[model samples]
Target: MALRKVLQQLENYKSEKPNRVFTMYLNTDLADQDQQGGEWKIHLKNGLNNFEHYLQKDGDSDEKRNFWAVKEKVENYMHEHQKDLKKSVVIFATGEGDIWFSERLQMPVQTAFHWEDQPVLDQLKSLNKQFPKTGIVLTQKEQIKLIDAELGAVNDTTLYELDLNTEDWKQHQGPHHADSNLGSGGVKSSKKDELAERFEENRSRWYKSIAPKIDQYAKNNNWDAIYLVGSSVEVDELERNMNKQVDDKINKNLLDHEEMKIIEEVM
Candidate 1:
Protein backbone atom coordinates (compact mmCIF):
# COMPACT_ATOMS: atom_id res chain seq x y z
CA MET A 1 0.00 0.00 0.00
CA ALA A 2 1.05 3.57 -0.55
CA LEU A 3 2.37 5.38 2.49
CA ARG A 4 -0.22 8.08 2.05
CA LYS A 5 -3.07 5.56 2.22
CA VAL A 6 -1.57 3.95 5.31
CA LEU A 7 -1.16 7.36 6.92
CA GLN A 8 -4.77 8.15 6.17
CA GLN A 9 -5.95 4.92 7.76
CA LEU A 10 -3.78 5.49 10.80
CA GLU A 11 -5.00 9.06 11.17
CA ASN A 12 -8.54 7.78 11.40
CA TYR A 13 -7.77 5.05 13.93
CA LYS A 14 -8.13 5.57 17.66
CA SER A 15 -8.06 2.85 20.31
CA GLU A 16 -11.18 2.57 22.47
CA LYS A 17 -10.92 2.49 26.30
CA PRO A 18 -8.69 -0.42 27.52
CA ASN A 19 -7.40 -1.04 23.99
CA ARG A 20 -4.31 1.12 23.57
CA VAL A 21 -2.16 0.97 20.44
CA PHE A 22 1.55 0.24 20.22
CA THR A 23 3.70 2.35 17.94
CA MET A 24 7.42 1.92 17.48
CA TYR A 25 10.09 3.46 15.25
CA LEU A 26 13.40 1.71 15.62
CA ASN A 27 16.65 2.65 13.92
CA THR A 28 18.70 -0.44 13.13
CA ASP A 29 21.13 0.90 10.57
CA LEU A 30 24.33 -1.07 10.99
CA ALA A 31 26.43 1.66 9.38
CA ASP A 32 25.34 4.35 11.81
CA GLN A 33 28.00 5.24 14.37
CA ASP A 34 25.75 4.67 17.38
CA GLN A 35 24.43 1.30 16.13
CA GLN A 36 27.85 -0.32 15.61
CA GLY A 37 27.45 -2.39 18.79
CA GLY A 38 23.82 -3.38 18.13
CA GLU A 39 22.59 -0.96 20.81
CA TRP A 40 19.09 -0.97 19.28
CA LYS A 41 18.53 -4.40 20.82
CA ILE A 42 19.23 -2.98 24.27
CA HIS A 43 17.05 0.03 23.52
CA LEU A 44 14.16 -2.16 22.36
CA LYS A 45 14.37 -4.30 25.46
CA ASN A 46 14.52 -1.32 27.78
CA GLY A 47 11.75 0.51 26.00
CA LEU A 48 9.36 -2.46 26.15
CA ASN A 49 10.25 -3.06 29.79
CA ASN A 50 9.59 0.58 30.66
CA PHE A 51 6.17 0.47 29.06
CA GLU A 52 5.33 -2.80 30.80
CA HIS A 53 6.54 -1.40 34.12
CA TYR A 54 4.44 1.73 33.75
CA LEU A 55 1.30 -0.24 33.00
CA GLN A 56 1.98 -2.60 35.86
CA LYS A 57 2.26 0.31 38.32
CA ASP A 58 -0.63 2.57 37.23
CA GLY A 59 -2.87 0.80 34.71
CA ASP A 60 -5.83 -1.54 35.27
CA SER A 61 -5.49 -5.28 34.81
CA ASP A 62 -7.16 -5.17 31.37
CA GLU A 63 -4.75 -2.51 30.11
CA LYS A 64 -1.83 -4.50 31.47
CA ARG A 65 -3.01 -7.62 29.67
CA ASN A 66 -3.46 -5.65 26.43
CA PHE A 67 0.02 -4.19 26.72
CA TRP A 68 1.53 -7.61 27.24
CA ALA A 69 -0.30 -8.98 24.23
CA VAL A 70 0.90 -6.13 22.05
CA LYS A 71 4.43 -6.47 23.40
CA GLU A 72 4.65 -10.14 22.60
CA LYS A 73 3.42 -9.65 19.05
CA VAL A 74 5.81 -6.74 18.54
CA GLU A 75 8.74 -8.80 19.80
CA ASN A 76 7.84 -11.69 17.51
CA TYR A 77 7.62 -9.38 14.54
CA MET A 78 10.97 -7.83 15.31
CA HIS A 79 12.63 -11.20 15.68
CA GLU A 80 11.17 -12.59 12.47
CA HIS A 81 12.15 -9.55 10.41
CA GLN A 82 15.45 -8.81 12.09
CA LYS A 83 17.47 -10.51 9.37
CA ASP A 84 15.88 -8.35 6.68
CA LEU A 85 15.91 -5.11 8.72
CA LYS A 86 17.15 -2.07 6.90
CA LYS A 87 17.90 1.41 8.25
CA SER A 88 14.65 1.65 10.23
CA VAL A 89 11.45 -0.18 11.15
CA VAL A 90 8.06 1.36 11.91
CA ILE A 91 5.12 -0.51 13.34
CA PHE A 92 1.63 0.31 14.61
CA ALA A 93 -0.32 -2.56 16.05
CA THR A 94 -3.07 -3.21 18.56
CA GLY A 95 -3.69 -6.09 20.95
CA GLU A 96 -6.97 -7.13 19.35
CA GLY A 97 -5.36 -7.09 15.86
CA ASP A 98 -7.53 -4.21 14.67
CA ILE A 99 -4.52 -2.53 13.18
CA TRP A 100 -1.19 -3.91 12.09
CA PHE A 101 0.98 -1.71 9.92
CA SER A 102 4.65 -2.56 9.70
CA GLU A 103 7.34 -1.41 7.28
CA ARG A 104 11.08 -1.71 6.87
CA LEU A 105 12.35 1.53 5.45
CA GLN A 106 15.72 2.33 3.94
CA MET A 107 15.73 5.80 5.46
CA PRO A 108 17.06 6.36 8.97
CA VAL A 109 14.64 7.23 11.75
CA GLN A 110 14.97 8.26 15.41
CA THR A 111 14.17 5.34 17.72
CA ALA A 112 10.93 5.81 19.62
CA PHE A 113 8.13 3.84 21.25
CA HIS A 114 4.63 4.72 22.34
CA TRP A 115 1.69 3.01 24.02
CA GLU A 116 -1.24 5.35 23.58
CA ASP A 117 -4.83 5.80 22.42
CA GLN A 118 -3.66 6.37 18.86
CA PRO A 119 -0.61 5.66 16.74
CA VAL A 120 2.26 8.12 17.06
CA LEU A 121 2.60 9.47 13.54
CA ASP A 122 4.41 12.78 13.70
CA GLN A 123 7.72 11.38 12.50
CA LEU A 124 6.04 9.24 9.84
CA LYS A 125 4.12 12.17 8.43
CA SER A 126 7.33 14.17 8.25
CA LEU A 127 9.05 11.36 6.40
CA ASN A 128 6.19 11.09 3.90
CA LYS A 129 6.44 14.77 3.16
CA GLN A 130 10.22 14.72 2.87
CA PHE A 131 10.46 11.60 0.71
CA PRO A 132 7.35 11.65 -1.41
CA LYS A 133 6.78 9.17 -4.25
CA THR A 134 9.44 9.80 -6.84
CA GLY A 135 10.31 8.59 -10.34
CA ILE A 136 14.00 8.33 -11.21
CA VAL A 137 14.99 8.11 -14.88
CA LEU A 138 18.50 6.85 -15.51
CA THR A 139 19.88 6.80 -19.04
CA GLN A 140 23.16 5.76 -20.69
CA LYS A 141 23.76 5.26 -24.42
CA GLU A 142 20.90 3.08 -25.68
CA GLN A 143 19.66 2.06 -22.24
CA ILE A 144 17.20 3.82 -19.91
CA LYS A 145 16.09 2.70 -16.45
CA LEU A 146 13.03 3.99 -14.64
CA ILE A 147 12.91 3.59 -10.86
CA ASP A 148 9.76 3.97 -8.82
CA ALA A 149 10.62 4.72 -5.23
CA GLU A 150 9.26 6.17 -2.02
CA LEU A 151 10.95 6.80 1.33
CA GLY A 152 14.32 5.61 -0.05
CA ALA A 153 13.00 2.18 -1.11
CA VAL A 154 12.54 1.08 -4.71
CA ASN A 155 9.06 -0.23 -5.42
CA ASP A 156 9.55 -1.09 -9.09
CA THR A 157 11.93 -0.66 -12.00
CA THR A 158 11.50 -0.71 -15.80
CA LEU A 159 14.35 -0.99 -18.24
CA TYR A 160 14.17 0.30 -21.84
CA GLU A 161 16.67 -0.76 -24.41
CA LEU A 162 16.86 0.83 -27.85
CA ASP A 163 16.48 -1.80 -30.56
CA LEU A 164 18.96 -0.98 -33.26
CA ASN A 165 17.22 -3.10 -35.91
CA THR A 166 13.77 -1.60 -35.34
CA GLU A 167 14.98 1.84 -34.18
CA ASP A 168 12.49 1.67 -31.33
CA TRP A 169 12.63 1.37 -27.56
CA LYS A 170 11.95 -2.12 -26.18
CA GLN A 171 10.66 -2.36 -22.62
CA HIS A 172 11.92 -4.86 -20.04
CA GLN A 173 10.42 -5.63 -16.63
CA GLY A 174 13.38 -4.89 -14.37
CA PRO A 175 17.00 -3.78 -14.16
CA HIS A 176 18.38 -7.09 -15.41
CA HIS A 177 21.94 -6.21 -16.46
CA ALA A 178 24.07 -3.40 -17.76
CA ASP A 179 24.56 -3.01 -21.49
CA SER A 180 27.86 -4.83 -21.87
CA ASN A 181 28.00 -4.03 -25.56
CA LEU A 182 28.70 -0.39 -24.74
CA GLY A 183 32.11 -1.31 -23.36
CA SER A 184 32.80 -4.51 -25.30
CA GLY A 185 35.95 -4.61 -27.45
CA GLY A 186 34.40 -7.00 -30.00
CA VAL A 187 33.19 -4.14 -32.16
CA LYS A 188 35.65 -2.28 -34.44
CA SER A 189 36.62 1.17 -33.19
CA SER A 190 35.51 2.86 -36.41
CA LYS A 191 32.06 1.23 -36.26
CA LYS A 192 31.71 2.13 -32.59
CA ASP A 193 32.73 5.73 -33.33
CA GLU A 194 30.25 5.84 -36.21
CA LEU A 195 27.41 4.56 -33.97
CA ALA A 196 28.34 7.10 -31.29
CA GLU A 197 28.28 9.94 -33.77
CA ARG A 198 24.91 8.79 -35.12
CA PHE A 199 23.51 8.57 -31.61
CA GLU A 200 24.78 12.03 -30.76
CA GLU A 201 23.20 13.49 -33.87
CA ASN A 202 19.82 11.86 -33.18
CA ARG A 203 19.84 12.16 -29.40
CA SER A 204 17.03 14.68 -29.24
CA ARG A 205 14.70 12.69 -31.47
CA TRP A 206 15.47 9.48 -29.62
CA TYR A 207 14.76 10.97 -26.20
CA LYS A 208 11.67 12.71 -27.53
CA SER A 209 10.29 9.36 -28.68
CA ILE A 210 10.49 7.94 -25.15
CA ALA A 211 9.53 11.10 -23.27
CA PRO A 212 5.77 10.62 -23.58
CA LYS A 213 5.99 7.07 -22.23
CA ILE A 214 7.84 8.34 -19.19
CA ASP A 215 5.33 11.12 -18.68
CA GLN A 216 2.45 8.66 -18.87
CA TYR A 217 4.21 6.38 -16.42
CA ALA A 218 4.70 9.20 -13.95
CA LYS A 219 1.04 10.14 -14.21
CA ASN A 220 -0.12 6.53 -13.81
CA ASN A 221 2.13 6.00 -10.78
CA ASN A 222 1.15 9.33 -9.19
CA TRP A 223 4.74 10.41 -8.79
CA ASP A 224 5.23 13.59 -6.81
CA ALA A 225 8.50 14.38 -8.58
CA ILE A 226 10.74 13.15 -11.39
CA TYR A 227 14.54 13.08 -11.34
CA LEU A 228 16.72 12.58 -14.41
CA VAL A 229 20.21 11.10 -14.14
CA GLY A 230 22.67 10.45 -16.94
CA SER A 231 25.23 12.22 -19.11
CA SER A 232 24.67 15.96 -19.50
CA VAL A 233 23.38 15.65 -23.05
CA GLU A 234 21.11 12.71 -22.26
CA VAL A 235 19.68 14.33 -19.13
CA ASP A 236 19.15 17.61 -20.88
CA GLU A 237 17.45 16.05 -23.87
CA LEU A 238 15.18 13.79 -21.82
CA GLU A 239 14.27 16.58 -19.41
CA ARG A 240 13.54 18.97 -22.23
CA ASN A 241 11.34 16.48 -24.07
CA MET A 242 9.31 15.29 -21.12
CA ASN A 243 6.00 16.99 -20.37
CA LYS A 244 6.24 16.37 -16.66
CA GLN A 245 8.37 18.74 -14.59
CA VAL A 246 11.82 17.43 -13.80
CA ASP A 247 12.42 17.98 -10.11
CA ASP A 248 16.19 17.48 -10.40
CA LYS A 249 18.90 16.23 -12.75
CA ILE A 250 22.17 14.52 -11.98
CA ASN A 251 24.78 14.49 -14.72
CA LYS A 252 26.16 11.07 -13.93
CA ASN A 253 25.81 7.78 -15.80
CA LEU A 254 24.63 5.59 -12.91
CA LEU A 255 22.65 3.13 -15.05
CA ASP A 256 24.87 0.23 -13.97
CA HIS A 257 24.69 0.95 -10.21
CA GLU A 258 22.42 -0.90 -7.80
CA GLU A 259 18.95 0.54 -7.24
CA MET A 260 19.71 1.36 -3.59
CA LYS A 261 22.94 3.06 -4.56
CA ILE A 262 21.10 5.09 -7.20
CA ILE A 263 18.54 6.18 -4.62
CA GLU A 264 21.31 7.18 -2.23
CA GLU A 265 23.17 9.21 -4.86
CA VAL A 266 20.11 11.00 -6.29
CA MET A 267 18.12 11.44 -3.11
Candidate 2:
Protein backbone atom coordinates (compact mmCIF):
# COMPACT_ATOMS: atom_id res chain seq x y z
CA MET A 1 0.00 0.00 0.00
CA ALA A 2 1.07 3.60 -0.50
CA LEU A 3 2.44 5.49 2.51
CA ARG A 4 -0.32 8.07 2.35
CA LYS A 5 -3.07 5.47 2.57
CA VAL A 6 -1.49 3.74 5.56
CA LEU A 7 -1.18 7.06 7.36
CA GLN A 8 -4.76 7.91 6.55
CA GLN A 9 -6.00 4.64 7.95
CA LEU A 10 -4.20 5.38 11.20
CA GLU A 11 -5.64 8.87 11.29
CA ASN A 12 -9.11 7.48 10.76
CA TYR A 13 -8.99 4.58 13.17
CA LYS A 14 -11.87 4.59 15.69
CA SER A 15 -13.40 2.15 18.17
CA GLU A 16 -16.40 2.18 20.46
CA LYS A 17 -14.53 0.68 23.43
CA PRO A 18 -11.51 2.31 25.06
CA ASN A 19 -8.47 1.69 22.84
CA ARG A 20 -4.80 1.73 23.79
CA VAL A 21 -2.54 3.11 21.11
CA PHE A 22 1.24 3.31 20.98
CA THR A 23 3.19 5.07 18.29
CA MET A 24 6.89 4.53 17.58
CA TYR A 25 9.44 6.20 15.34
CA LEU A 26 12.59 4.25 14.58
CA ASN A 27 15.80 5.66 13.13
CA THR A 28 17.20 2.92 10.92
CA ASP A 29 20.52 4.43 9.93
CA LEU A 30 23.08 1.95 11.19
CA ALA A 31 25.89 4.47 10.64
CA ASP A 32 24.59 6.67 13.42
CA GLN A 33 26.01 5.40 16.71
CA ASP A 34 23.05 6.51 18.77
CA GLN A 35 20.39 5.30 16.28
CA GLN A 36 21.41 1.71 15.76
CA GLY A 37 19.32 -0.12 13.16
CA GLY A 38 20.42 -3.51 14.39
CA GLU A 39 18.85 -2.91 17.78
CA TRP A 40 15.65 -1.22 16.60
CA LYS A 41 13.46 -4.27 17.00
CA ILE A 42 15.14 -5.07 20.30
CA HIS A 43 14.51 -1.60 21.62
CA LEU A 44 10.90 -1.64 20.45
CA LYS A 45 10.29 -5.02 22.00
CA ASN A 46 11.84 -3.85 25.23
CA GLY A 47 9.61 -0.81 25.38
CA LEU A 48 6.48 -2.87 24.85
CA ASN A 49 7.70 -5.52 27.25
CA ASN A 50 8.39 -2.97 29.94
CA PHE A 51 4.95 -1.51 29.53
CA GLU A 52 3.43 -4.97 29.67
CA HIS A 53 5.33 -5.68 32.88
CA TYR A 54 3.77 -2.62 34.49
CA LEU A 55 0.34 -3.68 33.23
CA GLN A 56 0.87 -7.11 34.74
CA LYS A 57 1.60 -5.48 38.09
CA ASP A 58 -1.43 -3.16 38.20
CA GLY A 59 -3.88 -3.76 35.32
CA ASP A 60 -6.20 -6.78 35.03
CA SER A 61 -4.85 -10.04 33.64
CA ASP A 62 -6.98 -9.60 30.47
CA GLU A 63 -5.51 -6.15 29.82
CA LYS A 64 -1.97 -7.44 30.33
CA ARG A 65 -2.68 -10.34 27.93
CA ASN A 66 -4.07 -7.90 25.37
CA PHE A 67 -0.88 -5.84 25.57
CA TRP A 68 1.11 -9.00 25.01
CA ALA A 69 -1.06 -9.76 22.01
CA VAL A 70 -0.38 -6.27 20.65
CA LYS A 71 3.34 -6.83 21.17
CA GLU A 72 3.10 -10.07 19.20
CA LYS A 73 1.36 -8.29 16.35
CA VAL A 74 4.06 -5.64 16.24
CA GLU A 75 6.81 -8.27 16.26
CA ASN A 76 5.20 -10.21 13.47
CA TYR A 77 4.90 -7.07 11.38
CA MET A 78 8.56 -6.14 11.81
CA HIS A 79 9.62 -9.68 10.97
CA GLU A 80 7.52 -9.73 7.80
CA HIS A 81 8.76 -6.38 6.59
CA GLN A 82 12.39 -6.46 7.61
CA LYS A 83 13.58 -5.56 4.12
CA ASP A 84 11.34 -2.49 3.90
CA LEU A 85 12.95 -0.83 6.91
CA LYS A 86 15.17 1.97 5.70
CA LYS A 87 16.24 5.40 7.02
CA SER A 88 13.20 5.78 9.22
CA VAL A 89 9.97 4.00 10.16
CA VAL A 90 6.78 5.08 11.90
CA ILE A 91 4.52 2.45 13.41
CA PHE A 92 1.16 2.56 15.17
CA ALA A 93 -0.56 -0.32 16.91
CA THR A 94 -3.75 -0.66 18.89
CA GLY A 95 -4.61 -2.94 21.79
CA GLU A 96 -7.34 -4.62 19.75
CA GLY A 97 -6.56 -7.54 17.50
CA ASP A 98 -3.88 -7.03 14.83
CA ILE A 99 -4.64 -3.41 13.77
CA TRP A 100 -1.48 -1.53 12.78
CA PHE A 101 0.06 0.96 10.42
CA SER A 102 3.64 1.46 9.21
CA GLU A 103 5.64 3.40 6.63
CA ARG A 104 9.31 3.77 5.75
CA LEU A 105 10.76 7.20 5.16
CA GLN A 106 13.85 8.37 3.31
CA MET A 107 14.73 11.14 5.72
CA PRO A 108 16.24 10.68 9.16
CA VAL A 109 13.79 11.08 12.03
CA GLN A 110 14.13 11.15 15.77
CA THR A 111 13.29 7.94 17.63
CA ALA A 112 10.19 8.52 19.67
CA PHE A 113 6.94 7.06 20.94
CA HIS A 114 3.69 8.41 22.31
CA TRP A 115 0.71 6.82 23.98
CA GLU A 116 -2.20 9.02 23.02
CA ASP A 117 -5.97 9.19 22.45
CA GLN A 118 -7.81 7.20 19.82
CA PRO A 119 -6.70 7.86 16.25
CA VAL A 120 -3.23 8.97 17.32
CA LEU A 121 -2.22 11.07 14.32
CA ASP A 122 -0.06 13.94 15.53
CA GLN A 123 3.19 12.19 14.64
CA LEU A 124 2.10 11.42 11.10
CA LYS A 125 0.73 14.94 10.68
CA SER A 126 4.01 16.47 11.85
CA LEU A 127 5.98 14.17 9.55
CA ASN A 128 3.83 14.98 6.54
CA LYS A 129 4.26 18.71 7.21
CA GLN A 130 8.06 18.64 7.41
CA PHE A 131 10.19 20.11 4.66
CA PRO A 132 10.15 21.33 1.04
CA LYS A 133 7.24 19.20 -0.21
CA THR A 134 9.07 18.96 -3.51
CA GLY A 135 10.36 16.36 -5.93
CA ILE A 136 13.53 17.13 -7.91
CA VAL A 137 14.58 16.00 -11.39
CA LEU A 138 18.21 16.51 -12.44
CA THR A 139 19.17 15.99 -16.08
CA GLN A 140 22.48 15.99 -17.89
CA LYS A 141 23.36 14.46 -21.26
CA GLU A 142 24.09 11.15 -19.50
CA GLN A 143 21.74 10.67 -16.56
CA ILE A 144 18.41 11.53 -14.99
CA LYS A 145 17.67 11.72 -11.29
CA LEU A 146 14.34 11.66 -9.49
CA ILE A 147 14.64 12.92 -5.94
CA ASP A 148 12.19 13.20 -3.09
CA ALA A 149 13.32 16.44 -1.48
CA GLU A 150 11.49 15.95 1.79
CA LEU A 151 12.70 12.36 2.22
CA GLY A 152 16.15 12.78 0.69
CA ALA A 153 15.48 9.71 -1.51
CA VAL A 154 16.82 9.42 -5.05
CA ASN A 155 16.33 7.19 -8.09
CA ASP A 156 18.83 7.29 -10.96
CA THR A 157 18.79 6.02 -14.54
CA THR A 158 21.61 6.04 -17.13
CA LEU A 159 21.10 7.83 -20.49
CA TYR A 160 23.11 5.52 -22.80
CA GLU A 161 25.07 8.07 -24.98
CA LEU A 162 23.34 11.05 -23.45
CA ASP A 163 26.46 11.93 -21.46
CA LEU A 164 27.29 14.61 -24.07
CA ASN A 165 29.25 16.65 -21.57
CA THR A 166 32.18 14.22 -21.92
CA GLU A 167 31.97 14.15 -25.73
CA ASP A 168 33.90 16.48 -28.08
CA TRP A 169 31.25 18.06 -30.33
CA LYS A 170 33.20 21.31 -30.76
CA GLN A 171 35.70 19.69 -33.16
CA HIS A 172 33.01 19.67 -35.86
CA GLN A 173 32.77 23.50 -35.86
CA GLY A 174 29.45 24.91 -37.00
CA PRO A 175 28.81 26.51 -40.41
CA HIS A 176 29.66 29.88 -38.85
CA HIS A 177 33.30 28.85 -38.30
CA ALA A 178 35.76 30.75 -40.60
CA ASP A 179 37.82 27.66 -41.58
CA SER A 180 35.80 25.53 -44.05
CA ASN A 181 36.08 23.79 -47.48
CA LEU A 182 33.93 24.48 -50.57
CA GLY A 183 32.18 21.09 -50.62
CA SER A 184 29.39 21.83 -48.03
CA GLY A 185 32.35 23.29 -46.15
CA GLY A 186 35.03 20.98 -44.69
CA VAL A 187 34.25 17.30 -43.92
CA LYS A 188 34.67 18.72 -40.41
CA SER A 189 31.56 20.91 -40.82
CA SER A 190 29.52 17.93 -42.01
CA LYS A 191 30.79 15.98 -39.04
CA LYS A 192 29.78 18.84 -36.72
CA ASP A 193 26.26 18.94 -38.09
CA GLU A 194 26.05 15.17 -37.86
CA LEU A 195 27.14 15.34 -34.22
CA ALA A 196 24.65 18.10 -33.50
CA GLU A 197 21.88 16.11 -35.13
CA ARG A 198 22.81 13.02 -33.13
CA PHE A 199 22.82 15.07 -29.92
CA GLU A 200 19.40 16.46 -30.69
CA GLU A 201 18.04 13.03 -31.53
CA ASN A 202 19.42 11.62 -28.30
CA ARG A 203 18.04 14.53 -26.33
CA SER A 204 14.62 14.01 -27.85
CA ARG A 205 14.68 10.29 -27.15
CA TRP A 206 15.84 10.88 -23.59
CA TYR A 207 13.00 13.28 -22.95
CA LYS A 208 10.47 10.86 -24.35
CA SER A 209 11.81 8.03 -22.24
CA ILE A 210 12.05 9.98 -18.98
CA ALA A 211 8.98 12.20 -19.04
CA PRO A 212 6.53 9.33 -18.71
CA LYS A 213 8.53 7.78 -15.89
CA ILE A 214 8.55 11.03 -13.97
CA ASP A 215 4.83 11.46 -14.36
CA GLN A 216 4.14 7.93 -13.23
CA TYR A 217 6.48 8.28 -10.28
CA ALA A 218 4.80 11.46 -9.12
CA LYS A 219 1.34 10.02 -9.57
CA ASN A 220 2.17 6.89 -7.60
CA ASN A 221 4.04 8.67 -4.81
CA ASN A 222 1.72 11.65 -4.66
CA TRP A 223 4.51 14.22 -4.42
CA ASP A 224 3.21 17.66 -3.44
CA ALA A 225 5.12 19.26 -6.32
CA ILE A 226 8.12 18.82 -8.61
CA TYR A 227 11.11 20.92 -9.70
CA LEU A 228 13.44 20.57 -12.64
CA VAL A 229 17.20 21.05 -12.30
CA GLY A 230 19.34 21.67 -15.39
CA SER A 231 20.24 24.26 -18.00
CA SER A 232 17.46 26.59 -19.11
CA VAL A 233 17.47 25.09 -22.59
CA GLU A 234 17.24 21.51 -21.38
CA VAL A 235 14.65 22.32 -18.76
CA ASP A 236 12.60 24.29 -21.24
CA GLU A 237 12.73 21.55 -23.84
CA LEU A 238 11.64 19.01 -21.26
CA GLU A 239 8.86 21.23 -20.03
CA ARG A 240 7.63 21.73 -23.57
CA ASN A 241 7.73 18.08 -24.55
CA MET A 242 6.37 16.54 -21.34
CA ASN A 243 2.70 15.61 -20.95
CA LYS A 244 0.37 18.39 -19.83
CA GLN A 245 -0.36 16.66 -16.53
CA VAL A 246 3.36 16.37 -15.79
CA ASP A 247 4.03 19.95 -16.84
CA ASP A 248 1.36 21.18 -14.49
CA LYS A 249 3.25 19.73 -11.53
CA ILE A 250 6.52 21.52 -12.26
CA ASN A 251 7.11 23.97 -9.42
CA LYS A 252 10.07 25.64 -11.13
CA ASN A 253 13.55 24.97 -12.39
CA LEU A 254 16.82 25.38 -10.49
CA LEU A 255 20.29 25.91 -11.95
CA ASP A 256 22.04 22.55 -12.03
CA HIS A 257 25.65 23.73 -11.74
CA GLU A 258 26.44 22.33 -8.28
CA GLU A 259 24.65 19.37 -6.72
CA MET A 260 24.91 20.48 -3.11
CA LYS A 261 23.91 24.04 -3.90
CA ILE A 262 20.87 22.84 -5.83
CA ILE A 263 19.85 20.74 -2.84
CA GLU A 264 20.23 23.72 -0.54
CA GLU A 265 18.19 25.93 -2.84
CA VAL A 266 15.36 23.39 -3.10
CA MET A 267 15.35 22.78 0.63
lDDT of each: 0.88, 0.58
Query: Per-residue lDDT of 24-76 in model 2, one digit per residue for the tens?
Result: 77777666786564877777767777777777677576566656666787778
- lDDT (tens digit, per residue) of candidate 1 on 1-267: 488889999999987658999999999999999998888899899989998898888858888888888888889988999788899989898888898999999888999999999999999999999999999999997889999999999989998877665668888887678534433444576788887887898888888999999999999888998999999988988988999999999999899899999999999
RMSD of 1: 2.5
Deviation (Å) of 86 in candidate 1: 2.1
Instruction: Give the C-alpha miss distance for residue 13 in model 1, angstroms.
Output: 1.3
lDDT of 2 at 8: 67
